[model samples]
Target: MDIKLSNKNLGLTPSVTLSIDAKAKEMKAKGINVIGFGVGEPDFNTPDNIRLKAINAIENKNLGYTPASGLPELKEVICKKLKKDNNLDYEKENIIVSNGAKHSLYNVFQAICNPGDEVIIPTPYWVSYPELVKMADATPVYIECSEENSFKMDTEVLKESITKNTKAIILNSPSNPTGSVYTKNELEEIAEIAVENNILVVSDEIYEKLIYDNFEHVSIASLNDEIKDLTIVVNGMSKAYAMTGWRIGYTASNKSIAKVMSNIQSHSTSNPNTIAQYASIEGIQGSQQFIEEMRLSFDERRKYMVDRINNIEGLSCIVPKGAFYIMMNITEFIGKEIKGKLIMNSVDFSELLLEKANVAIVPGKAFGSDNFMRISYANSMENIKEGLTRIEAFLQEKTE
Candidate 1:
């Protein structure tokens, strides 16, 4: 019998960030000393208070399923968080909690996209954005944002991309690979276009708390009532609370969209983890000292990485205003020979670095740009120091 897999998933590319991290872990298991700057998750453990709350729930209360949307208390806390942080007022009816921010994104696409609908995604985007759009049966239109522009979408380019078939546009602040935070002024411009075109804006603010250099994270939805109605804000505890494994993310939108997402999640995953939902309540309402400390640590690491990468002979990167990642420019080394390997693209550079220097990183090709590689400063100070040192030595071995 000949069995075939679904055509929908066949074209999906695996996550290069996770793939590199996994390979580094495997090498470490085999006694190889590999330094990884691949995964974007914080290296810090979940805060003591939040973990204690989970323990208390597990020991005292019955850990079971929650409402398809979320716990009422948790949803209330999320609304309060939105009001406090983003200056956006939302009621419980406007929220839908999912397994992770990625899940929230999936639901947003599925909720709005029909066949042939176009979602405008900026280049050097999160690796999963285009794939998620494709999975929703939508076409992902790209606008290549250059490094000189800080990798942000241009309002004029955005205007030209819109069409009758345009359904939505994704806006990621403190963006994943580039760490570019959208300013309030820039958001207002995009919000104007979105409002005029009646295009939905899926504003992803997962790195809102990880900002550095006094850069403020502006939610496009919070700019005005018109854009707010056309926006779905996605956020979660994974980045800020070091709760990646807990699998909790949420979306805030209009009631009609929220209801549709809630219904879809009801039959699909039922609910996010019950215990996690309860713990997230404490995470939101508890003291915020941990978040401050984590942000300071990430800022320090980010500074060190930017300076160190720039000092290295063949590598340089722009100073990221937010998030823990730096898009290291390797264009200077392209078409050159390094340690007997011809560096043709980001993938070639990354593979050779991993094999020669034992330092793992994600190629920019994964993010629709092939001239750079993404390095996360989420690793320890010692590991980052050692990894960059190794990289410096490896690049110094260039043959031409």
Candidate 2:
């Protein structure tokens, strides 16, 4: 007898980034030296303070479940954080803590979406956005954000995309894959549109603290009271505090939506890791010096990666203002023969580099763009240098 899987999940696409990273790790386990640039997690260890806090919790505090949504204390801390960092005032009633920002986003979609509703997503999005929308039984409307526009959704195009069926739009700043941060002006325009159209804004701000060039992060929710109520701000400790494994993520939205999300999560996963929630409280209120150090390190690597990739023939990348990934344009190499293999798209170029040079980078097709590939600078400078050197040499290689 055969077992049936959920039809929705069957149609779901597995994460290409994780798959590529796993393959690279498998090669490394087999003694192959693969320099991986896939997956966006910071390579730095969780800061000592945060780790010690977890230790302290395990030893001192009760490890029992907290509230279904999150610990009240943790929610209080998150509320304060939003006011201090984002200038958005919210009560604990409006916040829901989930396993990770990814989980928080999933909760948002599930709670707000209805069947046949449409959620607008900008192209070259984080790998999970469209998938999450589809999982909610909502249609994902794609808006192609061009490279020339720094992959940001333009207001004009956004207006054209909205319709009676539209339920929401996703805004990711210091965007994953492209590292594009929207300016305050751009967000203000978006805020106006959202308010007019009565569309919810699911703002993913997980990379807020990883921005560079002193570029300020402006939350679309902070623009006005109306927009604030219409926005669900998704963030977590994973990117900023290097707490990927801890899996603490949250969302700030209207109280009604938060209640729905909490109810949904209560049955699904229950309270997030109780120990992690306690630790996250400490991570939020503890010394933030670790964040600065990580940001500076990433900034250095980002600069080096962009400069080197630009200098190399047949490849180019725009300077990313925030986040730690570079979207290297591989269009120049398309339809050409490299190492006796025809390179037609980002996936072909990525596979060639991985097989021949042992450098693992994500093809842009994973992010909805086929003319580019994304490389993360979350690795050390040494590894980044080695990876790029290998990539450059791979581009020059010829077969007998």
Candidate 3:
């Protein structure tokens, strides 16, 4: 007899973003010339000083497991970084370091949500937010954020979505698919709504340092004491430090929530990697040079990608203020034929690009927006230019 699978694991929709990335890699393994616009991590390597610290930890025999939450030194650095950069204060006891920001969010949802609690998520949300809520046994309530509004949810939507069973709201700034960052005024209003309703706010600022055009990131927790009490700030060394492979991400919340998450982690994965924790200490406290250089490079690519996407016929894009992904609006191509393939939606469009043009991009339906496709410019300028050129040629070949 076959063993029955658990309900939670059975309910998940495998991540579409990662699926596309894997397929692109598979094609390239077979020696195909596939230009990928699906990468989410920085193309830069981890700064030398940070990597050296990790090496030092292993070389000095400091690789043993420390605490379930995190290394105290890493937590302390997180606290200092919060106060200095995000204007939020937290003690070491209030932080829990997890395998990655993704894991941190999964733990936060598990800690705060109950069987049937509701989480308000704004779409086009990061692909994982809704799934993470489901994994926590909570209901995901989506408020469709419009492109005209820069895809940022306002207070009015929040008020309408909240109910007595509402448990929390997940906020991702410098958002993944849309690349929209919330202004301080908007965050203040959102924070006020949570305060009045006695609800929790989980702010995911993983892309906090990748912002462009001088758009400063504001944490909802930093608005006031009331929201601070209700907010959990999630960040990591992945995006900012180009340490995605190191797998270190953390959460800052009230001690009660942090303690419970730590308890849960202790019984589960124990601590995050010991060497990675040591490296993160240096990542936060060590340097300003590589961060600025990488940010500048992304900004240049962001400008070029937006302009090129807009100029293409049957395609358009709003200039993303932060993050590295551009959501190309492909509404005009829907119901149209390209090389005998009917582009019914963003997925079809994405498939056509991959099959015909040897290009890879993600469908917007994965982010809950069906009329657009998300593309990453995290590759070299040569690849980005070549990828868009192929897409342009493909469109012209069919439209003409």
Candidate 4:
């Protein structure tokens, strides 16, 4: 029998994280003790109050389908949260909820992009952005961010990338692969470029609440009225509220764009989970003390990981000002052999570390960066210590 696949399906690449996760599972099943760090999820469980709210909803028979866009109460709470936190004003109609920030973003790209349109994505971006763009039949134009610039896109490079075919640019703060948070000044410069080119800005602020050291997260839409109209802000409860499994995410944008996104959602997944929507309303409207506690914990772990990684003989890491992942440069260890296998690139390095040291880390090539690897600090303090110790010993054995 012959099987056929659509162009959309053929365009999509397998998820790199899932591939690593599957390999880790196979090794673990074979009795290898693997410290898996390839996951992009938080190690914490959903908060008790949030879980109870969902449970209460389920008990109350709130299991019916929701509005195609979202629950009215959840949408209202999201609007309020946006205004309170980001100083961005939006009516309830301007928001559309989805399964996760990932779903919301995929919908947004599907709604806005046309075939052959170019999306300017900064390199070392989230692994899914380029794939999603391709799935929409759009081209992903990479704007490389160098290590010297702290892995942030240069304004000049951004300006130069705009062409008539360019339709949008994706801005991810506290970026996934590299924990680089764009400063207000940097965002303003990028906003100027976006505004001038009439390019829509898809700001992924999923990690907004995960910042450290008083680093402010500025919404590009808040820069001015003009920028606001062209900016689509995507956020959700997954990272901050530890509700990854709940699958509640939303976006605030121009009313017309919001409507288009909602229409796309109507045909796609229809609506987010009803219980999750109810829980997310509580997540947004309830007390935020838990968020602060989590942020503080991540800050401590980030400092410890960066310091320890830098102390290693051949590995150098920059102190990330925000997110919980550290993109450490392992270029110094390239070309070296471990256990008779030569480490040629980030992929080879990650494989060697996993097989030899029993510690799993995501290679930077997944995020479009080659000479580095992302080590997430989202696990426990003990796990962080053990993982780093294994990494250090592995490197020492190779370099010595």
> Considering every candidate listed, which one attains the maximal lDDT?
1
How many residue pairs collide in each prediction? 0, 0, 0, 0
Whole-model lDDT for model 3 versus the true structure?
Answer: 0.92
TM-score of each: 0.99, 0.98, 0.99, 0.98
Model 3, 1-400: lDDT tens digits are: 9999998879899889889889989999999999988869999999999989989999999978889899998999999999999888899999999999999998999999999899999989889999999998999999999889998896787799999999999899989988999999999889889999999999999998889887899988998999999999999989999999999999999999999999989998999999999999999999778988998998999999999999999899889988889889999999999899888988899888988899999999999999999999888999999999999999999956
Off by over 4 Å in 2: none
- Kindly indicate the candidate among 1 and 4 with the higher TM-score: 1
Give the Cα-based TM-score of candidate 2 against the true structure.
Answer: 0.98
Clash pairs, candidate 1, are: none
Per-residue accuracy of model 4 over 277-370 as CA lDDT, tens digit each: 9998878888888888898998888999888988988889887877678898989878878778888889999888888899889888888987
lDDT by candidate, in order shown: 0.93, 0.93, 0.92, 0.89
Per-residue lDDT of candidate 2, residues 1-400 (tens digit) = 8999899989999999999999899999999999999999999999888888889888996699899999999999999999999998999999999999999999999999999999999989999999999999999999999999998998899999999999999999979989999999999999999999999999999999989888989999988899999999999989999999999999999999999999999999999999899889989999999999999999999888889999998889999998899999989888989878888888888888889999999999999999999999999899999999998887876532
Please report, as a residue range, the 10-residue window in candidate 2 with the lowest summed lDDT. 391-400
Model 1: per-residue Cα lDDT over 1-400, one tens digit each: 8889989889998999889889889989999999998988999999999999999999987487889999999999999999999999999999999999999999999999999999999999999999999999999999999999999998899999999999999999989999999999999999999999999999999999999888888888988899999999999999999999999999999999999999999999999999999899999999999999999999999999999999998788999998889999999989988887788999999989888899999999999899999999999999999999999988776644
lDDT at position 227, candidate 2 = 96
Better of 1 and 3 by lDDT: 1
Candidate 1, lDDT over the whole model: 0.93
